[model samples]
Target: MLVFFTFVILLALTVTNSKQTFVILKKSREDWILDGIGLFFQGIAIPFFQIAVVFQLYQLLLPDTRASLNLYPIAAFLLSFVFVDYLYYWNHRLFHTRKLWFIHQVHHTVTEMDVLGTSRNTLWTSFFIVYLWIHSLFIYLLQEPNWYILGISLSSALDLWRHSSFSPTVNSWLYRCLSPWLILPQDHAWHHSQFIQGNYGANLKLWDKIHKTYHKSDQVPDSLGINSSLSLSKKLFLPLE
Candidate 1:
């Protein structure tokens, strides 16, 4: 519910903001096809797969540990928001490396900041992401995962927001509060910039700051995304450098 609400709000903001709306209007047919397919696969298929296949697979592999680890609500939340977040930070950074860049480059092909492009990636790229495995494993192991689920929801919401052009005004109270810790849209724009060198954390800037990959900037990059010669089919299936 929260994630949906967040998406609606962000979409509304994107449609209303002239600059963002222009970006949306400029989207090509191929962009729509890629993003639409990505959205359906990420939003629908991924969840269903997690519940039906991944969770069941975990049940078979760790039958004795199904919902066996009981934890306090706060502990479970922290486990997802902090521990898993840290793990994904490294996982995301690894995607930028030469060996894995081919699989991840499709996502960085977006030329502008738009929510629709949030999930843009090769179809099987989710398998390389830490969330698919770690999130399912934790949900299976934790006896009560409500708080953990909430954490996931919040993280997912942030992902949507950071991928869009919706951002708090600079120097505003909201910006001041969130910019110090959270990964804002502008922060993420740097990651998707033509350079694509730093700011790799998904939810928090702590990991990037700690690792010296955080690029502090008050302005969005003039140029965004990488130019890809790969066709839509190749991008969706086998994106080779």
Candidate 2:
């Protein structure tokens, strides 16, 4: 729901505000098809994955904790912002390694940044993502706290914004203050650069800083994605192979 709604809103913004152009890649029909296939596979996998997550959470929960909501909803909600982002940082870093890079490469293939562009990886990419699996399990174990849902809602909105082409003007004090800790569109746009190793944060920049992978610079990347071209079959199956 969050992903769907965010995509719609951002796409609308992109279309309406035509004058503010930040497109890096010229999108083609092939690109749209690839993203659509990925999105379809992702939607199909999620329900099945959640079924497993539910069963696993049931097995792990204490007998007395059944049918209970989070005792500390606020803390759980606040903590999810840090916890989920922390998990994303490591999961993302792992994708850049030699073995996993192929699975993630599709996302960077498009030089452009957009709401749909971010979800353009191969079918299995989302299935094996560590952060998604672990985060879902955690939410189930916590009994679906309201705060946790709220935190995720806020984070998902930001996620869409970061993937979109708009780079917010950083002149405001709020931007300056949050720029260090939170990821903005500019921060993530650079991650799609050919130099894709650094800036692996999801919502917060703290993990990248701690791991010494944070990158900030005035220079926009010269180019995006690798030069290698992949066939449709390869794009769909090479990651698994």
TM-score of 2: 0.84
Model 2 segments more than 4 A misplaced: 1-3, 19-25, 43-48, 51-69
Q: Name every residue pair that clashes in candidate 2.
A: none
**Prediction 1 TM-score vs. true:** 0.97
The lowest-lDDT stretch of 10 consecutive residues in candidate 1 is 232-241
| Cα shift from native, residue 206, model 2 (Å) | 0.7
Model 1: how far residue 35 lies from native, Å:
0.6
Q: Give stretches of model 1 more than 4 Å off.
A: 239-241
**Per-candidate TM-score against the hidden true structure:** 0.97, 0.84
Residues 154-211 of candidate 2: C-alpha lDDT, one tens digit per residue:
7777877888766656677777777878898878878988865799988898898898
Q: What is the RMSD of candidate 1?
A: 1.4
lDDT of the candidates, in the order given? 0.92, 0.73
Encode model 1's per-residue lDDT on 1-241: one tens digit a residue: 9888988898898889998889889899999999999999998899899999999999899999988999999999999998999999999999999999999999999989899899999998998999999999999999999999999999999999899887899999999999999999999999989875999898889999999999999889998988999988998997442
Question: Worst lDDT window (10 residues) for model 2?
Answer: 18-27
